[model samples]
Target: MTAGFFEAPRAAEFALRNVRVPATLAPGAVAPATQDGHLDVDIAIASGRIADIVPAGTIDVARGPDLRRSVVWPTFADVHTHLDKGHIWPRAANPDGTFFGALTTVMADRQANWNAADIEARFDFALRCAYAHGVSAVRTHLDSFSPQAEISWPVFAKLRDRWEGRIALQASSILAMDPFATGEGDRLADLVARHGGQLGCVTRLAGEDHVGVPANFDDYMTRVFELAEARGLDLDLHVDESGDPEARTMIRIARMAAKRKFKGAILMGHCCSLAVQPDEAIEATLAACAEARIDVVSLPMCNMYLQGREGGRTPRWRGVTLLHEMKARGMRVAVAGDNVRDPFYAYGDHDMLETFVQAVRILQLDHPMGDWPQAATTTPADIMKLPATGRIARGNPADLIVMRARSHSELLSRRQSDRVVLRDGMAIDTTLPDYRELDAIVGMK
Candidate 1:
């Protein structure tokens, strides 16, 4: 029944000694105290909360097993994901693996299937996978186009209640901007507010004209901002999720937020086009984003699979946003698991650790690793407004992931399947759901 590298002590009071923890997670560790971005510490747990943390040998050596410098991380928070659209690749595989292919396949699947029960089954499965992987919180984007919104939002509410104590769940509405220009945005906003969810949409309008930002982009953007502001709800948007160098809606959104004095938090995801813009444009956009206090989350795995993709050509650039530039400008940036086994991305397990690993390589977050690990843990937790979800402090719940990987080199080199996930200082099962369980539901005979 034990599934971790080591089992947590059965007693309510104990300590884990000689563990390496990210310095950023340990509020007490100063820059000078870190050994290459990590600090060796002994953590004492009592009654399901972190009791104390001090230098490696501060606790009696016999109090706990020597972790031998194993890296211990705060359990993760995935701030941007598509739970309603996850795990559809089984029956609705993308024909060409292009952006349009994913869009069309997901739309078709939504129409043909996607009833409440069907969605609840798949969404619950994804959450189970996330919980088992040590994710303490998640914010998912629901496909809120007309009836789909009606169907998906209720299911999300039910699951949110069901998984309340296990994983903190938040949902945001996702659709094209055209709805906001019309009156559908108001209707959707009402539904979102009733369910205590965020108002969101993609910047692109709904039509055959698949060019850059729409000519009426500002008009619709105004509506969306007004809608969110009126209801005191946050905004989570899909911005410029393409490689077309001209897709520059991100800067416009940031500027609009500042101009309107929008008080609610705004989180923009999948800003892939920023990477291809001119240097001046990039700097201007980043400055605007910083001034507006906009948070950015890059979906590296999904962007890589969908962007710069043509039938038979090599992808010249990695399809991620300017994470380093944005971070350097004092903006909060995060990495998240966007789609899991869906048409948009054919592979993911709802594992934020895996997302961070892939992001480190895709965004070149190494060179020092620095505080990049926060992108998955603290950064996303802050974005999701869950202060206690992804932190390792004396008064916080002892929800943590302990891995045998002593250094970043070892952490990133292997999958870390044997890692231990502790919730309330107790080890829970890490077994993933059987894929065969979905065979019947997905029609995968």
Candidate 2:
């Protein structure tokens, strides 16, 4: 009930009675029914760290207790998102729904009103939305190509420092071409490093006029990587975001990282090219990615909206990366809400549950390993390298969301709502919203 109760590294205890969990914690497995259709589990939180999890009935509920009865799971972590562009904008709709059109809209709107106050307000609203939806950690992209990085990057840093107890923040310096040229590479990297941010690049910059300088894709990427290494920062590149079959930038980056022995810190987002690549190429690329330990983050919602409609075909491209194949190859794959309600994506409620549902349906992961929801929820946590979060086990972070659905199929089929959300063993919002509304939105019964 107190604000400090949920802060990190504080020892608080909680009990959840009558909860069902999946049978296996492996990649993809069906969550089994509870033996008694109820579980009495006790969660111990200390110093904002999950200290222990014990049988609920083992502890006496009468003595100084923080307890609740509902399904509990780890807090969600979004490995990729553009937090600075979280607000909705009024602009010419993309009739063609092409990636280029979306990019143009974003560019126009960003140029129109991208300032420190505007960017901070949007990011603050986004962080609040993420917290209300039970997302405790996120890696957000800040467009460094815009001179606004001088304003936005500091806002993100301040927010991260202020909310360290509630969220873990990672700022990605977006190296995509904007108002800046390739000549600004060293300065940009220095700027990001000055603010404790990481390096990010977009392999393909959209536009024609900038083609001579910053438009040089190969040179830009090489410079970004070189600067990243020089600054001792990690890389998260938007490699081949379009559906172009010829875009093999991710493959090249993978090979380069492997050759340089890059320590598995790079994340390649929206490698949509991999979805359409030849089988041999896909295999080789996956192998190289695994060898280099490159992390792959697929943005289903944005990619589905922007790139899938190309060529005007029925049963449009799913716009999802080779998630299953990548998993099989032992590559770390995390799915994120890349853009939320912005020019690039007209939708995104900042709820990762929706993202999980899309993954299940688009990836046909109903029977992944054995359980669908568990895999859908847990895999992303592992991919994001979140050790204290994601699984329902002893000593894990007490950040959890309790859903109304009884089974994985029920949860997925209904897109069930989180009935209760707890951060650090204390409930924040206990009101259980209707999942039926979401079901209707997704065309589910």
Candidate 3:
């Protein structure tokens, strides 16, 4: 709490009464936020779930925490993240800041120091950043390029237990689908099952430029589906992350998933190529996604960091998925914090609201107030399969955040970092990661 926040007279009002919260920030909301008027409501929590919603001044609030003219909203959930490779940007720095450069630098660093201890430290740092910024859940894409997952899995499972009910931690294997031939594919699926994580893949069905058709593409995806079907695990893929218009693997995957009627939830991250496709093609792809019940995870931060640099000339299109079209088609789309201060994206604090702001700007997702907040809240929580998450209704879990900003515009500004995070009605004392001195480790690189 900030200084002078706990005035003795208004101690009761500070918690649940006299708070002018925006009426719109909730799951499945699409209404524009009206600036002139705010709602006065008192929220009551009991046993971790919302006990009641009464008019302000009606509820007894002698025990309310000091909100300091803050707005209360559902805590955020990051649908996509790369945790195993997080917080190593200095050691994984690439002068060019290109996508390929990130891969090269991070792979080299990982092969050197990505043991259980190192990975756990970096992962802990990233999670702390998330917790401090009102994120209660995250789906991290673990580094699964090798058998290292067998080692990393135990560490993540332990943290999942450690942060239980506070921050729901879900993980997936981010690996190439081509290695199924070497029998490593089975091992990866088994690893995910053993840890109860999702099966993930970076589906590279196209070449570097990715403007032309891919050879033996379906064969690769067949193996991916086979593994998912065998293990009954959900599928999350890195699909069509390239900027090329012809990198249309997202469409193919959607059609295939719909046809196969895959049982588990299917999620796709970074459908950046869909932006360049023709309107007809894009609409068809979105329709297929809707039919397959696929959740499109838009990662504005990493895509903005990596895309359009190699084109030399000022790039015409930003690296982003078609959020407007997808939303118009009634498809499920949520924004996420993809990579946090890793080789892929060199800027982040594991703040999902930061990602929400980036998506609002880069994707021009000027969705009405209630709708935009849902991207980070209810929508992603549903995609994460978190049952009691992402809403502030009666009987919903009291996983919430109180920020020093009251208006929707103030929320987007992201200027207020002083806030209280609550899980099941208890305040959390959060710590931030320090990253000041990296000269000895990263200066030489």
Which candidate has the highest TM-score of all?
1
Judge candidate 1 at residue 262 and give its lDDT. 91
Clashing pairs in 3: none
Name model 2 segments beyond 4 Å from true.
Answer: 1-12, 23-70, 91-95, 177-182, 206-217, 310-315, 369-385, 430-445
Question: Weakest 10 consecutive residues, lDDT, candidate 3?
Answer: 4-13
lDDT of 1 by residue, 1-445 (tens): 5468887787798899889888987776532345568888899989888999888889997777789889999999999999999888889999999888888889999999999989999999999999889998999999999989999999999999999888999999999888887778889999999999999998787633235778888999999999998899999999988888888899999999999889999999999988998999999999999999999999999999998898899998899999999999999999999999999999999999999999999999998889898899999999998888787988899998999998888999999999899899888899989888888889887
> By the lDDT metric, which is better: model 1 or model 2?
1
Best by lDDT: 1
* Cα lDDT, model 1, residue 410: 91
lDDT of 3 by residue, 1-445 (tens): 3322222222212245545455544433222334533455666667666676555666565746434445677788898998888778767776687777777787788788788877777787778789877789988988786767777888899889988866899999887656765588898889899998999887673123344335677887878888999989999998877777888888788888878888888899998888888889887888888888788988998998888876456656678888777877787789999887778898888887778888888887664544666787878988887756766666777667766677767767864566666667666655465654333433334
My TM-score estimates for the predictions, one after another, are 0.98, 0.82, 0.90
Give lDDT per model, in order. Answer: 0.90, 0.66, 0.74
Per-prediction backbone clash count = 0, 23, 0
Choose 1 or 2, whichever is better by TM-score.
1
Q: Residue pairs in steric clash, candidate 1? A: none
Quality of model 1 by C-alpha lDDT: 0.90
Once model 3 is optimally superposed onto the true structure by TM-score, how far is the C-alpha of residue 437 displaced, in angstroms? 9.3
